[model samples]
Target: MGEKLNISPGELRASAHAADTITKDLGRPLSKALEDIAAAADSLRHWSVGPQLKATGEGWGSALGKLRGRVGEHADGLRMVAAGHDVNEENVLNRFKGW
Candidate 1:
């Protein structure tokens, strides 16, 4: 009566790897770009709107940092899930080896 649940460890691992790649590929470059923009804004300190622009860039950087952290956490969670499932499956198979 219960629905069957199917999990593919390989797929989970692949997804985790993709997440990690995304974090690595995008995170550093984007963070660096934001810092550069903030630095550029700082150069305009004499202008009335320069401080606002700098603040905006810093805020975006902070938000991106949080997002990167969250993505990393998700990747870790996915890997853990995949490994756990593999172990569980192995344990189940071992229990039935004598049958």
Candidate 2:
């Protein structure tokens, strides 16, 4: 006998929703922080360390952008999985109805 795999589409969707919320939550604050860093870097451009600071800030911004994109992709994958499971379940039920 094969082991049963119980899948919950609702749970998957909820998790995806949570991930989306997290992405949104991080985006607002981090974006503001980056803007502040950029402004500070501009203000201190004459100082020797100003360019370094700006470069570091840009690096962080790029990394964060990649992270955000990955998280969004994860959320999309979760939704896709949930929908696939839902369709599979529906097809199974329809087969049983014929019996």
Candidate 3:
């Protein structure tokens, strides 16, 4: 098998710092937007036209689903990038001891 490449601690720290910043920036805006959308959806129940109200609710649901997908992608990217730094020779050897 080929030798494993090692990631320096400094590089890991930098990558983690960037991810933290990005998560904070994105999380706040997405949370606020989702809250506003949910409030709007709740208010739709007060509409007089039943079909129109239901349509509005469905639109909100679809929008929320898209927002969730975006958030999930960002979160997964952060995790994957962070995982790249979560390694070392000792840990790798320990994990693959039988190999």
Candidate 4:
């Protein structure tokens, strides 16, 4: 087979850092917005058209919630990728030694 692949975790770690930054940027403001929306929705619940307003607020909150969740997941995924690459290299070395 070709020479054993040489992999470095530096780049992966950098990517993970970038992902984490993005997650914070997206999730922080969104969390604040969600809280505001919840308060607004609660206030609107007493009006005649309150149901519609509440529903709209809920929809917006839901979408933002999903986005924040996804951003968090993405960051987690990147961090996992960064950490996993080192583990993968160790596994390969162990298998190669066994062989």
Candidate 5:
């Protein structure tokens, strides 16, 4: 006999909640860290001896911001999908906890 995978509405809702939690947790710290890094980078850029170094620092900071910017978007998208699932699943909270 072959085993089949069983999923319940409650499980789906729980998974969506978890996704939302993870997104918030990750986004909160990332924003703070990025701010601190940007401030330090700005200070370093200001004190640099040559224009080249200042420009490099500015370029790197811009790149960092651009790259990390997508994290929040991706997290938000994940959370949006999860929230949709929560609403779409009927009687989600009452579903069985199938293993």
Candidate 6:
């Protein structure tokens, strides 16, 4: 007779719990520049590319207002993404019991 393999249900339960906790903890939108870009998505899409370019050149006097600038911060985030690093900040309050 061949021996049967058995997997512990407790191990699977623990893994599922850990994944759920991490998902909730990592789901936060925490960048002022990102927030601004998201806020302008609708207006940005409505304007044609050339018009948007010319409007931007016209300075902040245009109806679209000033173009948001977060070049350095956005670049840093891009680098982190390129490096395969998770950009989300870990939730300090969500650590295993006693944390």
Per-residue error at 53 for model 6, in Å? 16
User: 1-99 in candidate 4: lDDT tens per residue?
Assistant: 335554457866676678678767877777777678677767877877667767777798788778767777776776787688889888899989956
**Model 1 regions more than 4 Å off:** 1-5
Alpha-carbon lDDT, every model: 0.88, 0.91, 0.62, 0.74, 0.59, 0.42
Tens-place lDDT digits, model 6, residues 1-99: 333533234444444455455444433432333445545654566667645644444443332222222333344444544334222223433454484
lDDT of 5 by residue, 7-98 (tens): 45455556656655665576666667656656665666656544455555567656656655555555556566656766666456557446
Could you give candidate 2's per-residue lDDT for residues 1-99 as a string of tens digits? Answer: 233555589988998999899888999888999999999999999998889889999999999989998888899999999999989999999989957
lDDT of 5 at 45: 65
Clashes of each: 0, 0, 0, 0, 0, 0
Quick one: ranking by lDDT, best first? 2, 1, 4, 3, 5, 6
Error of 6 at 62 (Å): 32
Model 4: lDDT to the true structure: 0.74
lDDT of 5 at 86: 63
RMSD of each: 2.2, 2.5, 7.4, 5.2, 7.5, 17.6
9-77: candidate 1 lDDT, tens digit per residue: 898899999999988998669968997888889899899788989998889888988998899899999
Rank by TM-score (best first): 2, 1, 4, 5, 3, 6
Cα miss at 68, model 2 (Å)? Answer: 0.9
Alpha-carbon lDDT of model 5 = 0.59
TM-score of each: 0.87, 0.88, 0.42, 0.55, 0.45, 0.30
